[model samples]
Target: MAVTTSPVDETAIGELKAEVRGPVLQPDDDGYDEARTVYNAMIDRHPGIIVRPTGAADVIAAVNFAREQDLLVAVKGGGHNVAGLAVCDDGLMIDLGLMSSVRVDPDARTARVGPGARLGDLDHETAPFGLVAPAGVVSITGVAGLSLGGGFGYLCRKHGMTVDNLLSVDLVTADGDLVHASEDDHPELFWGIRGGGGNFGIVTSFEFELHELEEVLAGLIIYPADEAHSVVRSWWEFISEAPDELSVWLNFSHAAPEPFISEEYHGERILSVIPIYSGNVEEGWDVIAPLREVGDPIADTVEPRRFVDWQQAFDESYPAGERYFWKSHNFKSPSVEALDHITDYAVSPPTPDTRVSVTHLGGAVNRVPSDATAYPHRDADFLVNITTRWHDSTQDDECIAWTREYFDVLAPHATGGTYVNFTTEPEGEQSMAYRENYERLVALKNEWDPDNLFKMNQNIKPTS
Candidate 1:
């Protein structure tokens, strides 16, 4: 606990805390600031050392001791990632959160997982085998950084993207070696880590490919942010005939005073319409009855739950040191002048802790084929996440200039992709989050991280 004074050498940090059984911390130990906390409480990092591995041979002896002590590394799995790319200020954070495990099999429908699993530990170990795994709808995110930055939620319009039900990945690479990858092993590093976010390696284990799903006819369909322009044009005309067991999401925020929201519209601005059908919950009550009748809702919690309680329904509006700021976009079928600049920036707000989200990318994420994996925005039909959450750090520069001035006012009806799992800091031109799969992910990062030492995510640089 309180130990201080480290000019790097206490028998090389006690031989990396005895070759990692787990727990290594050092900024004068005692859970070094909760092992360098992450998930963007405006990322205040400080890692002179902090391992906590406990698996895949302690992440291969902490990536071969951070490449023979060259240092600068950061990998924490479920520290919920909001672009604090898991934590690294002094260098070397590798905290794979005690390698949280989740090993479902249900007669090999699959689900190995554990690069510090989460998404409520693979939906509580595959919901007693009624199975599932199309990830991220925030049950404390991180199923290995949401299937390496390409996962989608509410059963991704009927399972796809969770790196399309992953299927394999053992990884460690960046020279620490482990390997495995899928579609017939090493298949171009499983199409560059499927959507390539941890750029070229560090995976550790994720198999996924399960899907049976027993419950879901999810809820939330609020309104009144002055009924956000007929609820964003009835959610762009009900996602142009959405159906692959339906899934919706078109938020805009404020109004969570809870008690099922109607205390005179609590904090005001709203428009939720969150739906999730995943088939037969009595036929998802007639397929979400016209999205529960679009605009007149001030609240409507659609029924038949248990898809792990609708994946922890927004876990108390994301509470973990909350100070966040994010911006993302990738639309290609949204015009009516981009839904009037998106229901006018979804009922305007530079503060009521801004929100704006929207997700509905075509059924089975556009029948996958924008180069089949490395997540090329399969012609994105919609995926905007603008969140600018806050708790005051002097309102981070006017909530990051209203999310970069409404992301440059919806940048020319955007389609220039971006969604490195809703990236936060690794400013743009990271090949716009792999458009045309960014030169084959920079040639799979010059054959698995050549000198790019896995540059803190959303990176793909090595071509020398």
Candidate 2:
């Protein structure tokens, strides 16, 4: 192995500028601060330089250049990492934000997307063809990071995880080789890449199997806050036996003073269910009628809508600007006692923007064998994500404490394993997130990258 002791040379800088198509924004550049920023405003990293590569060739050059200097490399796809691992201090940052192109195969029902594409960009391109991929529910999440972290979305019930639909990927490995991976080629690497975060390589492009998701009967159905117990109990019963075509997400929060919500409900705690029915609209209507008729909903906005429209529904409320502290747990069931705990927290949340959300975790996601990929929680019924969102940095301690307390209170119900996508702390609990799969991940890490060049993610140590 070779290493350079001298500081970044002028010739090396010139070589980098010549290879990349996009701008190489250094600390002196005008957009350096904005370019290096992740979605969370709380991340205050100052990378030595940020390289926005335009294509695989550019990415290869960037990877090789960093390797030559033995510098740390941080790969930023959607910049939505809660732990802010996308950027690092005194390291080389590879920003893939410019690779936002989507190419759809309408006849085959598939799409080949660039690594920089967001969920919204992919949806808008594929929806016109009456096709969709299992991307994140939020529109702004990057396809690369989300898909690699084992994407969970509204379509998981009808379809599967984003990684489950992944047909192939074009990645630049630690050796700076641009290789294509699929079931037919480098299958083990493909399997590891499906849910392995940024541990193996930097993905430049992805080929995913899309579904014919033309019309969706989806939106929010809000019930009064006090009625959470009844609604949640009925919801638990209704979803347990509901057909595979329906996927529902539950939320408890103070009603925002938006135009769609009633004025009287503003600032009042409420329970809302966001459902996406992938089958016929009439069938969806029949499936969700039980909840609508159970209580006097402050609002019921479920109806037949374009698939693209439904994907962007939550973007406004959870924008990129807010500081966030998130904690998550996977449960065997949404027991009444668990609902009781959530209800107790909802009435008096730490902040107005604080929320507790439940995402259905069964269906195609559970069909995969537990050791098939890096994602573990195969048998869990629901994923409970407790988030504390506030605008001011002064509230950081209070917000994080509230999230920790909620997780502590609900710990009795949790199965101990967690979803790494929603994980923040990268310590003891983080190690448990992978469950029994941690050993296998270590072997894969050693085989592909012994030096830990890609150690800037939810790290799976080579010796762990």
Candidate 3:
């Protein structure tokens, strides 16, 4: 009843490899297995070929070769995509992990970052200058994919979504030409790329306007697990009245087995209120004290730290090569019932690494009009993410089912629309996720890539 697809064309793949200026890995190459790996260990795709492009010219060459060979091609920035769109089975993968350059123009308050650059690289570069870009909370996330997907971070309340700060992007189109797209150049493409994911082309580099942020008062305050319900409720009411300069993410999980954590507390359920204040330290403490006082906290680690240090706060817990499954939903309101639902399941997370995070998404993020870019959920107060992590395949079902059930329980409270970056690869969900933006994206796809050469991502099929 079903037709099975065959393997990639060996001859064409071999030819394509020769065109890249950097290393090209074939199925039998020594580094082939490693090259095809993405951040999520759950995704194990075998591409026809993997090429690491060194620069814009290299990316152009790979794009042209893939188009000529009529091969499915995927662009991998940080390979941190939850859906694993960065690498596809039997497709050509343009791995950009090697391009990690970040050049900051302090005078212009802007930075030009390579596609392969990770959030950690960008943060480290900008930290010295007392400036930073709003990126994912996890430092290892690729700057390009996160930016293109309308990234939100701790600074989102004060600054804006990552796309809001995006100035321009250097893209290699399906036609094999390298072009710069910004507000003034290729305006249509620029608008689409901001929150559109990588539907149109492979972005070689991104230019973003940086924010002036110095020693930020940021860290976590951990309370007893039993107080999670009250703490989350208090947080919802408190953060809603917080000034734009203050943003806090609520996390409910077990204390991890890290060196910083006490041995007795490891695997014990805990309630943590992680806040970042983009303001003076003294004033920030005054604002954060109420949260620490909510329930008798077992530990209070909140203090003044560099912005980059705060960005990498979760790095140790979310190290690479682990099985990671996460789901996110934006909320118009944090109803009391939602908090109860979240804590009910959070009490027994499948793994110690499991986390339930509530990210504040209004303030600067909502200031931008809904129609300005492809990211449309502008009125949401908070975006809740259900994350599951485990090291063994035996526990895969347990971890995945937990995340799914958690979202299922809170479905009524969820704002139906999805953020492109946080979406899953299931067929019907994606189309309905980007509802209104769907038509505009389809039109843009037809104009730029009618052949669907870039259909490997959160796809927007061309309408003929």
Candidate 4:
């Protein structure tokens, strides 16, 4: 005989719909399928109910209802998480899609943003003021998840990670209480949320300290695949003494079929470097000259461009619904042997969409004290991510194995620490990601959320 689970009560769902202003969706609802779809196509979960919350009150109502019904709760902001933490099977999903909004205070040099806002939405609102909040490279990523995981991008070297710019956060706690966390109020919760993942609550809004940024000298520069080892060596040396105003990331992958790239190099394995100078354009030109002179280049798009334009440069490559598997490591430095191993993998990728990115991480990122927040890897010199993307589900095992193998080969050179945002598993090597702060975070988790209501993310379980 086969067993079947009981369905959620329709009467209870109706009561929830009447209590909240936003729409409540059940499995049979018209928009339920669309609401449950996340950024990664690899995840296919059917939540019991989907709540589209328009404001904090709706979130409070949804959380309370889930608690009363003893149902698991999953929160979705932009739903861009690689691990698909935003959706859960047979649970209630609190979708914040309708709450996308941004309010900038030019005089205060700060912006208050809704949790559902993407990087592009925040950038569009802040660009007119010649200010921006330091965020990740992908524009579609949610501000809440990125900031909570310690965001890094082109401006990271110049200013700092996104969490460093965070001024305040408004969240709904496990017990359905609305609270404001900052340096002054609920100081402990604020510290935990900084690079702590979503272990404590559902953050509804974020206040960020914006920095003045206008145009930047930035673009992509591609070199032949054979020169990868030498190019990496040169880049490593240059970054050792590079100014804080500049940030660069090296990509080892096949060349894309784009108008800017030469047709002959399309689909060919190549070494590409993206350098962005967030200072004076004239000085930036002088500083980036050596990088252009590296080996014989196939194509170069390095020139002056708007900072907003540079942020969205890689948007097209990472479209929604693509099957993506990622593995990352934090390293103080890479040895010559490691570079050679990386070159070997780059020369023969499982798919054309697979890419290995090495991002320099020493300027402002290293300046922050490790104990200041839950993010503890403050001294890492570089962050390496192995991304494997493919179209077919049948190729899942192959792509995943390749990513793991690549990480294993380079593990010897890594610092045993990984970025919380890049981790694909729910429970990562906790000690590595949190370092000495793991136990402290667990204690905080116990204090804030004893029941572990927000266990959908990279979870930090309560110690008690």
**Which candidate tops TM-score?**
4
**Could you tell me the lDDT of residue 400 within candidate 4?**
88
Candidate numbers, best TM-score first, in rank order = 4, 2, 3, 1
The total of clashing pairs for model 1 equals 0
Write model 3 residue lDDT over 3-46, tens digit each, in one string: 11355566766666676678988788898898888888989998
**Model 3 ranges with Cα > 4 A deviation:** 1-18, 257-263
Candidate 4 structure quality by residue, lDDT tens digits, 194-295: 999899999999999999998999988898788888888888888888899999898887888879888998989998888999999999999999888888
- Using TM-score as the yardstick, the better of models 2 and 3 is 2
TM-score of 3: 0.95
Residue pairs whose backbone atoms clash in candidate 2: none
Worst 10 residues of 3 by lDDT: 1-10
Error of 1 at 207 (Å): 12
Q: lDDT winner among the candidates?
A: 4
Clashes of 3: 0
TM-score of each: 0.37, 0.96, 0.95, 0.97
Please give the CA lDDT of all the candidate structures: 0.81, 0.84, 0.83, 0.88
Off by over 4 Å in 1: 3-5, 8-10, 17-41, 50-75, 81-92, 97-110, 117-131, 138-140, 144-225, 228-250, 253-272, 285-287, 290-292, 296-346, 351-353, 356-464
Per-residue lDDT tens digits for candidate 2, residues 31-65, read: 89988888877888988768999999889989998
